[model samples]
Target: MMTSAKREAAPANGRRLILFGAFDRHNFGDLLLARCAAAGARTDIVFTGLAARDLRKFGGFHTLALADAIAAFGSEDADFVHVGGELLTTTAWEAAVMLQSPSDTARIVALHDRSPDARTAWARSVLGTTRRIPYIVAQDDLPTRWRTHFRAVGGVAFDTLPGAERNEILRALRTATTLSVRDRTTFDALRHAGVDTDLLPDPAAATPALFGATIGQRGQGGEIAALRSRMRSWAAVQLAAEWGDDATLDRVAGSLLATSAASGTGIVLYRAGLAPWHDDLDTLRRLADRLGAQRPVAILESAHVLDIFALLAEACAYVGTSLHGWIVAHAFKVPARCLVRGPADKAARYTDTWCDVPRQWRTPEDGPLFPETISG
Candidate 1:
């Protein structure tokens, strides 16, 4: 675990720690990061996100809007911790769009798409920031008395951003009281930019150690209970909406069909996030349709974060495009493989940085799904 002397001193000074990240949405990794940060903090903590959202139904915190949370602290001493995630490359427009309800996302996206001025106006209206990278707040955005800390955050594609945006992110990191990155790719990029940072594993790697029992208990009830009762043995499968095209789905379905035939285990498909660009029920349904009832393939429609954890925890193996799915599965010592677009993909970069085991990455063009090592 990564500990800081600043965090240790905060309790003595009675400074409340405002834990901030992408927790306002339903992404499994972001929600898990919030829980892990809260569980590990020594002082009182408040959860803040891009928007004020109550996600308790999904096993997440009642998150406050970034601006509101900062204002509430006023001149009081506090520690602002950017909890964790691939937060660096997210633009203002992307963040704002993800926070909107699925129904409102299409109209908002269309409006933003039509005009650059409209995009800026809508992003500013929703996020309360004009900065291109709104998620990583600079010192000017906070109270003068508050301190900043960033813990094990990932930004694998930081090098691909424009110079001005890169400088913006650098300015934010330079002001942090303590800064650490989750992947070597991000660390090397920042280092080349003249900013030094500690390299650490993603915070979610500690999920099994911190919340193993709680997660297991959560599985004993609700939708997870029903799933557990139904599948005697299964492999947890998940993919983002970006891979939902017919051709990609056919490739994935073919690989999965062969795996099911060989192992005689059922397939359980789950959504890792409900944000606009994350997972899609329709996409998962499409993949399921291609599977065509060859075996007991089931779609887990639950959005609860721990339920997602429980499903992965109880699986015979995990195969997906989600980094967190691989992280959680690896945490529980479950055999797993992560699907990636290429070597530069975030999941691929992360595994390259920290995974000691040989990686078996299945891309869209790959024929076989799981390697011989990942078996039921």
Candidate 2:
């Protein structure tokens, strides 16, 4: 460790900071939240997210769904519950307030979403951790992003060894490896504290098994395409029926491994939420035939939870409908082209989250990419 500050160690237990946000959607911020909130103990990721994959590699220390979360933690026993990220809608705020494991959970809601104003006092009052840790981690980058609409007011910069501040941190965090800033000052401080851990790539794979990436790539486009192409040649592609779950994706994947000679181009046409839309099996067959036409696709059902990330990462190029496919494809830097039900649908939230990553050339085709309704 040689360059900057210390990693934000998850605070001691009983001092757990429960964060509630829209983690189910697979958006960048959601992924970032899922990846970041597990820094300290007693930490639980309460999400309304669509993903059911292993988040530990992506920093999911302790995760629970909102429906199953109430029993997991109540509002009367903890020191505080810090509101995480820029989520301040009525439901999000309400959920954030209720996530406290203690009834006396002091709400230290960060002003990251919008600064606390007199008008929002009621919402702020509902928080449980403010009294214990009123201080907000409003980093330098945030001020520039929110100079006018909101204010940090009395907050600190977000440079608390930010996982995504630089490549090393991102890679380490992404892989779930122990990471300290790569500078002498930071390393010496931790070493003196008797905390030494070997560094390994975060278990979350960066390069897809079928892609061209020999290195780190997250937000870059060309890198993803190359990676996907690489997977197309090396890894097994599970062409799941667009409506089947992850389990079907696995079976289809198994079929590829079993039937096809290992040319590294096995694809499964897995289906997720799309199964219900088709009225009959024949219609689904027709649709799947068309959807799976351009590339080599085989009909498979949606997959189970555990295999989604690995299965997607194993592929170099993912041409599909599900948001998870797009995300896993993009995370490994595999070139992903989505045929989302709606152009700017909620499913697009994940892709859209990282949509701004690659610097795309301006063209008539690009106009649709930039949603006009959001161009305020």
Candidate 3:
């Protein structure tokens, strides 16, 4: 565990650090990554994302636009840290759409879906970057005095990226003073492209060690408190909205029902991310409705990042599609099972690289089941 003194220590010679990532949105993992990076920093850190966003209400930082951040601090001698996430394969289109409000996402997506030229223009306009990979900044993007570091970032789908985009990412990574990836698949792909990177666990793995006390405090009140009081024991459940179809929900509900019956644990559904294309509260509510009040099922609709962490920290086990949720559960030594569409999923890749636990892959006949490792 890092002591407060160590964590609060200023950077050597008082150099500033620009912590950059896709944290401008409400995604749980991105916000958590920003928190982890900030907690571990030994310098004055400025959070930067694609757009200027004040997400503090959700326990995220007041992020400045990356372009604005560069203009404001680029001239200074600062260290640029690309805070860890699945940033490598994120296209400008995806990042642009995810950065929008949920209500506006559909309209923007629809307007640009059929027009490749319009989509490209809109993505570049929204992200304010012309780089093929907008999220991964190249050395030339910053001042000559600035140094770059890519820390524990993941790109499980990097191999599938277009040749031009892959080259663009490689060019940026080559200039990093320190580069590390979070999974073997990503590391292997980068190595195949002649970019050497250290393979480290996702930074979120250290969540419990760094913020367990804070998370515990958060659970003592509000929705977390009510849920804990209502159910003696519960499993934290989360899944992306894409899994909300009738057949899929039915399978998932059946599995949850069986697990609840067998272990006498209630179900607590939480949204891992509220950004466009992320988890949906309505999807979770639909799942709750399917559970049919037979077992104690509660939907945690809070968008505050710590609330999600608190829910996970207090749970006996976790079953979710969110890799960060599984990672946090593992950090707390709480048994967890990640639900994935297939073995190629990012969650599967991450767990395969760093975990001994088996992840559940969704099948037509059966949804994800509770890992047998979770004893009643």
Which RMSD does model 3 reach against the true structure? Answer: 4.5
Candidate 1 matches the true fold with a TM-score of 0.94
Cα TM-score per model: 0.94, 0.35, 0.94
Rank the candidate models, highest TM-score first.
3, 1, 2
Tens digits of per-residue lDDT, candidate 2, 208-282, equal 442334223331333334444434442323222333444433333343343333333535443332112211233
Model 2 C-alpha RMSD vs. true structure (Å) is 16.1
Estimate the overall C-alpha local distance difference test score of candidate 1: 0.85
When summed lDDT is taken over every stretch of 10 residues in candidate 1, the lowest stretch is: 1-10
What lDDT score belongs to each candidate, Candidate 1 first?
0.85, 0.34, 0.85
- RMSD (CA, Å), each prediction: 2.9, 16.1, 4.5
Return the candidate ranking by lDDT, descending: 3, 1, 2
Residues 221-335, candidate 1, lDDT per residue (tens digit)? 9877887787778889998999998988998898888888788788999999988889999999999999997878999988888889899898888899999999999888888
Off by more than 4 A, model 1: 1-13
